[model samples]
Target: MRTVRVELGARSYPIYVGEGLLPQVGERARQHLPGRRLMVISNPTVLGLYGTILLEGLRAAGWEVLLAEIPDGEEHKNLTTAAQLYDRAVSGRLERGDAILAFGGGVVGDVAGFVAATFMRGIAWGQVPTTLLAQVDASVGGKVGINHPQGKNLVGAFYQPRMVIADVSVLASLPGRELASGLAEVVKYGVIRDAAFFAWLEEWVEPVLSLESEALIHAVATSCAIKAEVVAADEQETGKRAILNFGHTVGHALESITNYSRFAHGEAVAIGMAVAARLARRLGLGFSQEEEERLLGLLQTIGLPTSVPPDLDPEALVQFMQRDKKVRGGRIVWVLPRRLGEVLLKEDVPLELLLEILSNQA
Candidate 1:
């Protein structure tokens, strides 16, 4: 297993990436604490896969384990769904010292982690991420949230996990399109930060897409390390860490405009990065056509969609972006591409320029 640590002082934890790590959850989690009830929150699809093994392992170790399975997908990321899981945790005899086990992909992690964040005014939660997107991004950062009607992730909190276990084995069961969707975030790590990592990915994207064991592990490990380093620097996105949202400002708006169904999170991000680069070039941030082409090309090579969802009103998209969390003081704080491997946060982007970008990219 490859281990990466998110150093948050008291909340510091390690992310373990390897094949068949699902069966090792009992041992890995016990290493964090002792004699606590675990409320395992997952969705039906994931529960049908690895839930039994995890239950058995913890049972064998004599830990009381309870299960709460929510329906899967981005559509379920809301207050009602979160409430059901919260209800289950409370009825399962949860205590302040007990832990909540988030046992699926990003959707599961986000809602379950939010439960952990709010349950008993914050309790221990560990991540057992099964999707590539969750393993590389969501599961590591401690930025847990549920989507509100107003926008995605509007109802949430910054609650760090006690540990994160990413089992490569579970990813094998993920359908092809879902796997491709996850790669969008993986590619984001390379685009906004590490040129060398991006180069490494250029060579390995095919192997990783093919689910070659070693390549996937290496990719997940490196992506986690990049996020960990950033999270340690800015746990609440006060400064430098905002660069991680290079594609997210517009990407989140895309998800919101589409009501989170028309496009996958990563797919929206794939398109968002392309648009942001054009905006960057417009603002003279040094990104050029070559950079935009390279990014779009990489996304296509990985089976990720680079096109914006058709029929979305450009004005409606702009209206949604105005409500994004990153926006402040009547200025959209766009995380723009200064160049490959570096991003710049610019405020007060002109309305006309942004609208023109919408027209072009849309």
Candidate 2:
């Protein structure tokens, strides 16, 4: 196993990435857990697949484990689901010293983390992320929350996990489409921070997508390392950390506009990145057509949609973006690309330019 540390001093945590790590979760988690009692939150689908092994591991470690199986999907990520989990925590006798383990994908992690953040005035928690997207991006960051009706992740907290175990073996069961969706965030990391990584992806992405053990481990570990560094530098997103939301501004707007029924989070982000690149070129931000094509081509090769859906209304999307958490004082803040592997957060973009770009796409 490979470990990446999110070095937040008092709040430091390790993200473990490798194959066959699922059965070792309890052993690793014991290092940070203060008590033997814990609850695991998972979706029905994931629980059926790996819950037995995880529960056995915890039980063998002398830990008492309780299970809370939530339904699968983004629509269930809300206050209602959180309340259900709260009931489970209370009935299961969870306490401040006890930990909550998020044992599924991004949705499960967000909801379970939120419960740990607010339950009995906060408690310890760990992550056992089962999906590539969650492993590479969501599980590493301390950010956890449910979607508000107004926007995505508007109701959440920066509650870091005690440990994160990302077992690449679990991804073997992932649907091809779901795996492709995750590549969007992987691509985002390359675009925003690592030019060399981006160049490497142009050749290595295929093998990674094919789930070759070495490539998959490297991709997950590197993505976690990049996110760990960013989160450590700007734990609360007060400055440089905002750059990590490279494709997320418009991406969240797309998800909200569709009520989160149309596209997965990473798929929406893929479209957002494509749109952002085009907009950057139009505004003379130095992104060349070749760069834009390369970006779009990579996304397409990974089976992600690189264009906005046909039926979305530009005006509605803009309205949703205005409600995004990143917006400050009613000004829409965009993380626009200057070139491959580099981006800047800008708030001075003219409304006319935004409208022109959105309208043209419509």
Candidate 3:
């Protein structure tokens, strides 16, 4: 297994990546807290897929086990879902020493982590990511959140998981759309932190889409390394961590504009990245249309959307972005890539410029 450490002082943790990790969840987690109860929070689909093995493993470890299964999808990420989970934790008699096992994709991890953060004034939590996106992006950083009626991840917390277990085997069952969606996050890593990785991905995109073992491992590991460094520097997104939001500013706005149903999280990010790249060039940030075009080509290679949908109102999207958490008080902070692997957080770019970029998109 490949291990990456997220250094957060008291909340520090490690991420373990490899295949056949489901059955090892209990043993691996026991290293941190020798004897504590585990409440596995999973979505129904994931529970059906790999929950049994993990549950049995925990049982064998002599730890109390409880299961709270929610439905799967973006629609399920909300206050209502979180409240339901809180009720389950309360009913299950979760205590401070006990931890939550987030077993599923991004949605499950987000909800489960939030539950651990708020339940009984905070309890331990671990992540068992079951999807490519979760392994590469969502499950690594401590950005746990739930969608609100007004926006995506609007109602949430900055809760960190004690550990992360990414079993790549679970990705084989992912739908094509889901895999493509996950690649949006992969592309984000290259755009923000590794130009060489971006260049490599320009060629490896095909192999990754085909689920080649080496390509997938390299992609996930590289992305995790970038995230660990960012999270280490700024656990609460106070400064450097905002660079990780390269496509997320507009991508999340689009998610809110569409109510998180029209586009998958990564799909929206793909389109948002293309928009950001073009904006970088238009704003004379040492970028070019060629870079944007190359990005679009790569996204297409993976079946991800590279263009904004006509149905979404660009102005409405902008309005939503202005309300993003990154937009402190009144001003908006944007993570723009001046070139591949070099992202800068700048607040000077006028909001009109953002509207201009959105308006030009079809």
Candidate 4:
């Protein structure tokens, strides 16, 4: 097992990445979470698959566990769901010292974390992220929230978790599409900070996708380490942390425009990254044709879509982006790539260029 620590001083927490960590969830939780009272929040699908193992572990460790299951999917990630969880926590009598365990994917983590942040004005929570996207990205950052009608993740908080338990073994059950969705975030980490890692992915894509133990653990651990470093330096996204949203600005727009039903979050991000690369090329940014093809080809190889759906209205997409949280003072702030392993946050992208970029179907 490899551990990566997100150094947030008093809020510091460790992310444990390895295969077969699910059965040890109880022991790990006992170490970080205070008190014995706990609420395990997961979706119906995940609960059915691994809930018994997790519950058995906690019970064996002498901890009282309350199971709360929510419906799965991005559409269900809303204030309504969070409110329901708040009720569950209250009814379960979870005190400030008690902890909420998010035992599913990103949706579960976001909703449960938000509940822990708001319930009793703030309580402790931990993440047992089952999805690759969650394990590598969402589980560590503490950027928890629910999607609003206006936008994705508009209603959320920067509440850190007590610990993040990522059992890579759970990924064996993931559908191929779900696995590909996670590769998007993994690819983002490479583009934003690690050129060498990106190259390694190109060579070892097969093993990584197949979930070979060593490659999988290394990929998850490296991504988590990069995220941990960034979060520790800029916990609230005041400056440097914005780079973490490399493709999220446009990705979130696509999700909001489609109501999050048509495309998965990572799929939207894959398209967003493609569009961003094109925009960078148009503006004569430092990205090269070779780099663009490499990025797009890798995404296609991973079974991710690399273009916006032709049916969606481009103007509406632009409007949604303007409403993104990254927009500051009515200007969209984009994290455009300068090269592999480097990016810059630019707020002065021309509106005409953006509109053209979004409109171009090819």
Candidate 5:
């Protein structure tokens, strides 16, 4: 197992990435999390697949494990579902000393972490991510929350998990589209942070996509390390951390405008990166067409969406972006790439430029 540490001093935690880590989740949780009564939150689909083994492991480890299944999907990640979880926790008589175990993908992690952050003022939570997207991005940083009516992740908090158990083996069972969705974030890490990693991806992406053990483990570990570094530097997103949202401005807007059913989170981000590329070229940010093609080509190779849905209204999309949490002084902060492995935050992008870019990309 490759262990990456998020060095937050008092809040420091470890992320374990490897094959066959699922079966060891209970033992790991016992080491990191401080609680007896554990609430394992997941979706029906995931629970149906690995629930029995996971529960048995936890019980064997002496955890008073309770199962709370949230209906799967991004749309269900809202206050209603959180309220239902709240009901379960109250009825379960869970106390502040207990913890929550996020047992599915990003949706499960976000809502469960939110509950842990707010339930009885706060509680501990750990992540057992089953999807590549969650393993590489969502499950690492402390960002947790549900979607609001206006924007994605608008109502969220920075609640870090105690430990993250990312089992790459679970990814082999993912649908083709879901696996492709994760590669989008994997590509993001290269674009915004490490040129060497990006170059490595150019050569090794195929093997990683094929679930070759070495490449998969390396991808997950490297992605987690980059995020861990970013999160450690700007835990509250007050500065450098915004770089982590390189493709998220338009990405989140796309998810909001489409009601989140048309595209997965990483797919929307893939399209967002595509749009950002054009925006960078238009603004003379030194991103050449060749570089744009290189980035888009990687996404295309992974079967990720690289263009905005033609049916989405540009104005409505802009309206949703205005509601994004990154907006500062009423100006939407955009994390646009200057080149592969580097990004710049710009809040001065004109409305006309944004509209024109969206129109062209669409």
Candidate 6:
């Protein structure tokens, strides 16, 4: 197993990436979580596949387990679902001393973490992220929330997990499109921080896509390490950490306008990155045509969409963006790539330019 630590002082935690870590979930939880009680929040599809193994492991480790299954999909990530989990927590007599375990993909992790954060004013939680997207991005960060009718992740908190077990072994059953969506976040890490990692991905796309052991470990470990460094430096996204929002600005808007159905989170990000690249050029941020093409080409090769849906109104998309969490003083903070390994946050992107980019993308 490859272990990457996110150093947040007292809130510090380790992310373990490897194959066959699922069965060890109980032992892992015992080490990090404070109490013996654990609520395993998952979706039906994931529970049906690995529930038996996980429950058995937890029981073997002397945990009093409470199983709560949320229906899968981004659309279900809302207050209604959170309230259901809250009801479960209350009925189970879960206490502040006990912990919660998020046992599925990003949606489960986000919702479970949100419950952990809000229930009785906050409780310990850990993440056992099964999906590639969750493993690489969502599971590592402390950002947890349910979406509001107005925007994505509009109602969330910065509650860090006690530990994260990113069992790549579980990803074998992930849908192909879901795996591709994850690669978009993995690609975001390379684009925002590591040029060499980006080049390595370009060279080893096949092995990574095929879930080759070494390539998969390296990809997940590296992505986690980069994010750990960023999060450790700026835990609350006051400054440096905001760069992690690289493709998220436009991506979140796309998700909100589409009602989180048309495209997966990673697909929206793939398109968002493409738009950000174009915005970089338009804003004279020094991004090159070759670099833009490389990004687009890589996403296309991995079966991700790089263009905004033509049917969506560009004006409407902009209006959705106005409601994004990153909006400061009503101006969206755009994380634009200056080059492959670096990005700068610009809040002054003109409305006209954004409209033009969106219109052209459409």
| lDDT of each residue in 275-352, candidate 6, tens digit only | 999999888899999999999898898899988877989888887787554355556788999999999989898888
Candidate numbers sorted by lDDT from highest down: 6, 5, 4, 2, 1, 3
Give TM-scores for every candidate, taking all chains together and pairing residue i with residue i: 0.91, 0.93, 0.90, 0.93, 0.92, 0.92
Point out where model 5 deviates above 4 Å: 149-151, 309-316, 319-328, 350-353
lDDT of 5 at 203: 93
lDDT of 3: 0.83
Question: What TM-score would you give candidate 2 relative to the actual structure?
Answer: 0.93
Per-candidate local distance difference test:
0.84, 0.87, 0.83, 0.88, 0.89, 0.91
Question: What's the number of clashes in each of the models?
Answer: 0, 0, 0, 0, 0, 0
Number of the top lDDT candidate: 6
Runs in model 4 lying further than 4 Å from the true structure: 323-328, 359-362
Residue range with the least summed lDDT across 10 consecutive positions in model 2: 323-332
* TM-score, structure 5 vs. true: 0.92
lDDT of 6 at 295: 90
RMSD of 4: 2.0
Task: Give the per-residue lDDT of model 4 (tens digit) for 135-191.
Answer: 998898899999888656888899999999888899999998889989899999999
Q: What global local distance difference test value does model 2 have? A: 0.87
lDDT of 3 by residue, 123-203 (tens): 888898988989998998788988767555777788888889888878888998988899899899998889899899988
Q: What's the lDDT for candidate 5? A: 0.89
TM-score of 4: 0.93
Of 1 and 4, the candidate ahead on TM-score is: 4
Residue-level lDDT of model 1, residues 144-211, one tens digit each, is 89887755687889998889989887888888887888888788888778878888888998899889
Q: Model 4, residue 88: what's the lDDT?
A: 84
Question: Cα RMSDs of all predictions?
Answer: 2.3, 2.1, 2.5, 2.0, 2.3, 2.2
